[model samples]
Target: MVRPLAVDVDGTLTRPKPDRGVDPRVFEALRAYSEEAPVVVATGKAFPYPVALCEFVGLPIRVVAENGGVVCIEQGDGDDPYGGGRFGDGVVYNGDREAADAVARAYEAEGHALGWGAVDLVNRWRETEIAVARDQPLAPLERVAAAHGQEVVDTGYAYHVKSPDVDKDIGLETAADRLGYGPGDFLAVGDSENDAEMFGVAGESWAVANADDAALSAADFVTDAAYADGFLEALERATE
Candidate 1:
């Protein structure tokens, strides 16, 4: 059985779209899961974004942000109440800042606005990952990555330009380091292309019913429900 459950925020727990809120029931499920084992939220989202979600859940869990480039374990008010702030519990990997900047410039050159829409919140704070627009206009972005020897991936909400050497699985592995979790000890849940990396690496990965065909094909398990409901359903089974 998995010791820590790695969850994806947007399509997996949220409304399957960016800037959406999580259902209160979803938080309930997360709390329940936390009671059994460590819980980790792994997403392409930036820092405080993860912080915001943790605040909402009110359950301290580790955050693997920026598609695994940045990881933070919440500092509990006191008492080490949640078993957070442990594990490889810190920012594990960040791509070259120069590479991130160049990718940002490339997005602009391709006529994509860098500081607009869903990516606005993370634009300034993401020092290591180049997160720009979503998949609608991403072929050029991939080309830019190829030119720069970088990697570009879509999270359904946004396309991220990050270090090719680092992926969600890499970040997830860092979180698993202290907990005696090999990839075989993880049960990851996600619903987008960015999630594919973790799906392949985790012991067992579940793609929510709402996930695209590619994502579903990548996972070891596929849920019948969508969004947070799908996640909660999987949570129940994983714990059982």
Candidate 2:
């Protein structure tokens, strides 16, 4: 049986921007699952985002954020009492300032107008690469990548020029080691390229119907429904 279930927040739990909120049935099912097993909200969202989500759903569980680069455990009393213990401390992996800067410099050397933003980390995933385009156009960023023989990945909130080597799997492995959980013991669910690594590491993995082609191709199962409905279905399957 899966000891802990790791769930992605954005496309897996809720729809992307313009529509934010959990599905009612999905929330209810998650609450029910929390009563029987440990449900971990594993996403790119950091600190307060995970904390607030737990509060909103009334679930007491651990969270893996920043695409497994950060792991925080929620504790204390009240509906939203989090960030209290060392468990709230996150383990950052790929989204490091140094790495981001290095990539930015590479872009500059290529004569591409580069842009950068400090992602909340907690609200993003690793496979979700960032492009430094806060005040620049995406076309220039693409040109920079092309000049460098690289590719720009759209991470929703940011664009990332990334190497194929870096991804969420590395982050998830680090989190598993820190938390004392084996790869075989956990279940992962997601809906994007960023979620690919977590899906690979977990014993059981799932992708939502709305998942990108890459994510769907890698997932163990694809839900008939999308977003929260897919999450709920995956949870039920995992528990069973």
Candidate 3:
């Protein structure tokens, strides 16, 4: 049996930003899962987001944040393991910093109207993808990249310009290895193009009903419900 579950945050376990929070019912489902098996909250969000979620849900599950840039296992010591010089057996790909910066600089050099929102540098098993959010349409970004023979993928939350090799899949695999688990030991779930990698890496992957077309297509299964409902469904399936 799979020993634990690794779940995405936005649009998987919870809604996206502005409304960035988990559904109460889904939180309850997570609580239920925690009693039976370890449930890891794996997300592209920064460390604080998952930390808040875990506190809100009152569960001490593990968290893999920043798209695997950071991983912290909840400890029974009532203190954060990541805070005390314990990297928690995770490897963060530091190479993304340079690659992500290059992409950002390229976008700026083209004079495309891009929002300089916080960029989350991701290194998923040596594959690099720079995640950025913008308030305007993405067509301009795409048009700019098309001229260079590159592509910009719309992940709902943001526009991502990646190496086409690195993605959530690599991140999940890295996380599994760090946690001493394997593909057969965890259930992966998400709702966007950024999540495609994670889905591909898991033995069984699930997409929320409201997930993007690409994500839904890539998933091994689709839940009948959306967001929190999807998480609850997956949790139930994992425990069973």
Best candidate per lDDT, number? 1
Looking at candidate 2, the ten consecutive residues that score lowest on lDDT are: 120-129
Report the CA-based lDDT of candidate 3 relative to the real structure: 0.66
For residue 115, give model 3's deviation from the true position in Å: 2.3
RMSD of each: 3.2, 5.1, 4.7
- Write the residue-wise lDDT of candidate 3 on 30-122 in tens digits: 776666666778776656667778877777746766565555665443356346534455335522545554656677786754464444333
TM-scores for the candidates: 0.86, 0.71, 0.75
Q: Write the number of the candidate with greater lDDT, choosing between 1 and 3.
A: 1
TM-score of 3: 0.75
Worst 10 residues of 3 by lDDT: 120-129
Evaluate residue 150 in candidate 2 and report its C-alpha lDDT on the 0 to 100 scale: 54
Clashes of each: 0, 14, 3
Off by more than 4 A, model 1: 16-19, 74-89, 115-119
Which ranges in model 3 have alpha carbons more than 4 Å from their true place? Answer: 15-18, 55-61, 69-86, 116-130, 134-151
**24-89 in candidate 1: lDDT tens per residue?**
778877777777767788888876787678767766747788888887654433246445444334
Error of 3 at 205 (Å): 1.3
Q: By TM-score, is 2 or 3 better?
A: 3
Query: How much lDDT does each candidate structure score?
Result: 0.76, 0.65, 0.66
